[model samples]
Target: MTSKRVFIYAGGEIDPISIKSIKQDDYIIGADRGALFLVDNGIKPHISVGDFDSVNAEEFARIQGFSDEILSCDAVNKDLTDTELAFDIAIEQQPTEIIMVGVSGSRLDHTLGNIHMLLRGLEQQISCFIWDRNNYITLTDSTHIVEDRGYTYASLLALSPEVTGINLEGFLYPLENATLKMGQSLGVSNRLVEAKGTIHIASGLLLVIQSKD
Candidate 1:
């Protein structure tokens, strides 16, 4: 069986054309101004979720006109960010992959928050990834494989204090049952030697960053 993918748009900046080629079989959700961003780019999100405070009346009205469903949250008294709310909704659908968009912007706090939100999906065994024009980030624990995407570089960083028993194969810089510390930069700027690559970890969380020039 094929896995289902969900594309979620947060209020961060994004280039719609980056994902313009994505097929119509996936689900789409917009958060706050993200909904306006989608509609402005002629991309119709299946539903929009978030507090209406971020977007102005004109943009909110515009979203309401075209979006299938608009879930408005209270701005002042809310526990979750718009993107988190969107993730909560996406989780309900039992998706296999969650592609987060418009989540990496100037706001450092929100960007970090969105990254940690992957843990929520992680617990549910959903393969959540953060994608932008130049970056692809995914969180992994234990063993994982990364195909040689024919890209420029791939990096692995420790999400927890330390990731032990780390192993890397088919990469420019390979590791063999090694341990990586959280603040270490040893796993940065790795290249692939073959068509596919593999990453294996025994404990702790790891963040894989695949990028191209």
Candidate 2:
């Protein structure tokens, strides 16, 4: 039997807990300085894809030696970000799921952009998640059952214009057929009340953020 291929994108400032959660069967993909983080943690990337802009010349050379495959991009001109490029390579491998780590710490704009890339994988029916020190973020359009074993606080945000007919079960603060609008904080900081929780939405896109303090 073939083992599932899990891809990890090491950005910067990877949480030790998060690193521990990463399985050995997973394949690592590094994005710029993210490559350095992976090497620092004694992980050799199966494939490294990024522009060397954020990586120093000496560090980039060292990372290239560690990577099985290296794809370099232009520092000046580029359409896709390094994270997106790494995602493309991971998709080519057709992994069971892609769990991105260290993609969310420093830059808010980069974090948001990486989150948006999850939608691309959604279209391909591949589960993708962005994980950092505090949170795991994913996009969902339909009903999702989240087992309470892994996460502490759960939040559902409207990614589209509006999310209607939102229902929550087994949550500290329950909602029935509620409409969650973009930029609304009402859905934030919800706790799971049972061993499992269910979030159902009749329409529109939703971003689920499962976090720990």
Candidate 3:
């Protein structure tokens, strides 16, 4: 089987540790200023897409030459955010999975907006995630198995009315056949007890967040 292609978004406030975690084989998609982040980190993206609002003139000029392809858009436009536009391009490439970085931090509203994009990807059955220094977030509607490495902590939150028949194993606190409601904090701060764990939800959509110190 072919390995999944991982797409990284260049946003502001990207953790260097997260950038290092990117393997040499992973694909990269830069969004506006995110392209600048890749250049600073000594990595050239496979494709760069967005309006060059956050990027300064010099940085934008530099990356324009390094990227495999550049898809420029108007700085002020309707329809989708720059990040979403980049994601659309990523989906077209048919990556097995996508990881968005530099997406969370500095602006709470923008972070929330990107999180909603994960929901949209979930609707398309695309395996997508949002990552930063302390958090790993994903949206899911069906049963999924999450492998726990010792690096981060994990939790599940209901995005819909209620998530039913939820099962969690190999964690500090495990739950079975439980119901998680929206706006509740019942599933927060769960740690992996074993090397790996699984989360199974029979119905409804959920947002899974894995964090570390």
Q: Which has the greatest lDDT?
A: 1
Which runs of model 1 end up more than 4 angstroms from their true locations? 148-151
TM-score of each: 0.92, 0.89, 0.92
Query: With candidate 2 superimposed using the best TM-score fit, by how many Å does residue 156's alpha carbon deviate from the native?
Result: 1.2
Candidate 1 collision pairs: none
Listed per candidate, the RMSD to the true structure in angstroms reads 1.7, 2.2, 1.7
Question: Candidate 2, residues 116-189: lDDT per residue as tens digits?
Answer: 88888888777788877778788888888777647789998888989999999999999999999999999999
Which candidate order results from sorting by lDDT in descending order?
A: 1, 2, 3
TM-score, model 3 to reference? 0.92
Clashes of 3: 1
Write the residue-wise lDDT of candidate 3 on 1-213 in tens digits: 466666667575676777767888888888988888887778889888888888888989988988998988887765787888887887776767888988888788888898888876776667898877788788888766666644567878898999999988777898989999999999988888887778888999889888888
The per-residue C-alpha lDDT of model 3 at residue 169 equals 75
Better of 1 and 3 by lDDT: 1
lDDT of 2: 0.82
Residue-wise lDDT of candidate 1 within 1-213, one digit each (tens)?
488989898878675765675568888899988888888888888999999788889889999998989899899899998998999999997999999998988999998899898888888999998877677788999777887655688999999999999999899899998888999999998988888889999999999988887
